[model samples]
Target: MPVSLVILAAGQGTRMNSDLPKVLHQVAAAPLLHHAMQAGLSLDPEKLVVVTGHGAEAVAKAARAYDARCDTVMQAEQLGTGHAVAQAMPLLAGMAGDCFVLYGDTPFIRPETLEAMLAARARHAVVVLGFEARDPGRYGRLIAEGEALQRIVEFKDATDEERAITLCNSGVICADTAVLADLVSAIGNSNAAGEYYLTDIVEIARKRGLSAGVVICDEAETLGVNTRAQLAEAEAAFQARARAEALDNGVTLTAPETVFFALDTHVGRDAIIGPNVIFGPGVTIESGAEILAFCHLTGCHVSRGATVGPFARLRPGAELAEDVHVGNFVEIKNAILDEGVKVGHLTYLGDADVGEHTNIGAGTVTCNYDGVNKHRTKIGKRAFIGSDTMLVAPVTVGDGAMTGSGSVITENVPAEAVALGRAKQVTKPGLAPKLFDMYKAAKAKRQKDQA
Candidate 1:
């Protein structure tokens, strides 16, 4: 069955005490809204809509950045969740599928949980996600018998008996797109809060002889961030889960708690990640790759058998092929190091390509930026770049070439050639002591004048 998602992101989150929209706040290095959208995206939804209010433009941009096909609608007023869903119905008009109402602040909803709700749609007209809360607190209570959910009672409007129910609503619902649009249209805001509640759809559907069901998930999966403290807790929760999953999948984390993972970090089996390694968005380490402690990697790929530093940064577009070794204090950006490339300490290879088995000595730099435009440096196979060698931009060292130490290479070196672009040393006899004597005389004169 085709699926569609309507994510509610219109809340101001005043408790968060920030001008940024609540859903734009990050967890796992990605906006909270992206997490919700990622779960929905796993279902390959036919249509995706985000209802935005506070910081609508920023939120809409973030949504489209994640999925360009996503459509965003403006919710000018903070009416309620039902009103928020209503705003997206027009965008989803004539779409035939199960429409899921998701909360942007809830970032822990698993894809399997949503699939379960879709499966439950086989027997009921509406399926609401419910959790057995450890502390129900102010959450709406789910009134259900077995798998059949009778109605949902808001804590503000619930009787004392209903308030005592431990099963709480998670604000995640799935129903037929047409049926959801109709149910939302029929909802009214006459209750305690005088807000149109999406929960009310249950009672309205039940009264119309349509059945409603509950799909239960872990209490942790229903965590919603509303405040600064809750945001911290959410971040911790995401890290804990990510670390555990990495360990379970055969990836080695020397210190799991100290390693923080972004939303889209992918490490293959047998890969070793040392302590305090932070993975930013779009990093992938293939099997047997070793990332040492204190290495921060973002938007880079480390191939099999590649080893990165104890203190190194791989910025966007940095790619290391199999068996490449990048040592400490090395920064690579917009560069590719082919197989068997050894780039040791104190090197910056940006906008360059090093061929297989090439050795880059310490303090070697590809001066890629010429103050106005960036250029490329290409080092062919088996080349040797001597220490402190500066390969100026738009230069190439050919196969089996060797560069002299402290050389500044401005032109290309042909295959099997040696390039040396430094001035020859000249010997000076008895010049050091004479210069020191003159310096001492000048110092004495300056001291006498000051007196």
Candidate 2:
């Protein structure tokens, strides 16, 4: 049977206290809706429909960046979840398939949970993900009658006893498209808010005497973010999960709580990560690579046995080959440092390429950006860059080239040559005593005049 995924992103999420759409808020360096889209795409669904409302243009545009082929539906009015899904009804226009309805604000919803719910499929029935929480709140309470879901009763619509049920509704449901279409049709805006909640479908299913089952998962997996505090909580949860996975893969994190990893970051076995390091997505560190504290690395590759700083920043396009050493206060962006290269202390290497066995001294900078466009600097094998030297871009230091301390090199140096570009020293032989006497006389005369 064909399966489709619909993500509802219709609400303004006013509680988040920001103008940006709730789905656009980032978690783990990716927007929340991107996470939802990634999970949906992993399902290999026949069709993926995104329902946008409040920030329709922005959200639709962002979604297109990720998957241009995805179909978008707009809810002109902010009614409720049922109305949001109703917007997507046209995408399912002629196709009869099972559709998994998801929320854009719930970025942490796992693909496995969706797959499990899909696997636990029963034709002609509703399957909603559920969790047993301490407080059900405004969420619909999942009341089950011994393995069978009795009904999802909301707080206002639930009895005192039913309201007290610990299992809370996750608002994620999988249903036969035709059955879901029928369920949406029967739902009326008769509730307290007068808004059509899709949660009403479970009760409607029960009233129709149909089988509605609950797919019980850990409550954390379904904790939707509606505010900044909840968003922070969700971020913490994602970080914790990523750290645990890293440790399980033989990577050791000292003070794991202080480290953050993007969802797609790949770390090899035995890589040690210290506190306060942020690994953005597309970062991959090979085995024996050690990344110390206070490092923010994104879109970089750290090869085997390499050591990155206790305070290094490796920006996008940085590649540190095996045994490379990048020390504190070094920022490398769009640069490649070959094996045995040591870039230590107070250096910025942007749009540069350094060959193997090179030593990039402290306070050295590749003047890569010229205010308008960027240029590249190349350092050959065994080249020694002296401290406090600036190698203007479009320049190259050949193999075994030695740059004198404090020299500014604008032109390329030939292989095995020493490039020392500095003003020649001119010294005067001792006129020091005569100059000192004149200064003493002048000082005395000035003092006498003042008196």
Best by TM-score: 1
For all candidates in order, the CA lDDT equals: 0.97, 0.89
lDDT by residue for model 1 (1-451), tens: 8999999999999999999999999999999999999999999999999999999999999999999999999999888899999999999889998999999999999999999999999999999999999999999999999999999999999999999999999999999999999999999999988999999999999999999999999999999999999999999999999999999999999999999999999999999999999999999999999999999999999999999998999999999999999999999999999999999999999999999999999999999998999999999999999999999989999999999999999999998999998989998999999999999999999999999
Prediction 1 TM-score vs. true: 0.96
Best by lDDT: 1
Tens-digit per-residue lDDT, 1-451, candidate 2: 7888899987788999999999999889888888888888888888888999888999999888878888999999988888888889878867676899988888877889988888767643899899888667877888887557777777777888887788888899998888888898788889888888898888798799878888889988887889999999989988989888889999999999999988678999999999999988789999999999999999999999999998999999999999999999999999999999999899999999999999998999999888999999999999999998899999999999999988899999998898898888887899899999999999999999999
- TM-score on alpha carbons, each prediction: 0.96, 0.91
Q: What is the alpha-carbon lDDT of model 2 when measured against the actual structure?
A: 0.89
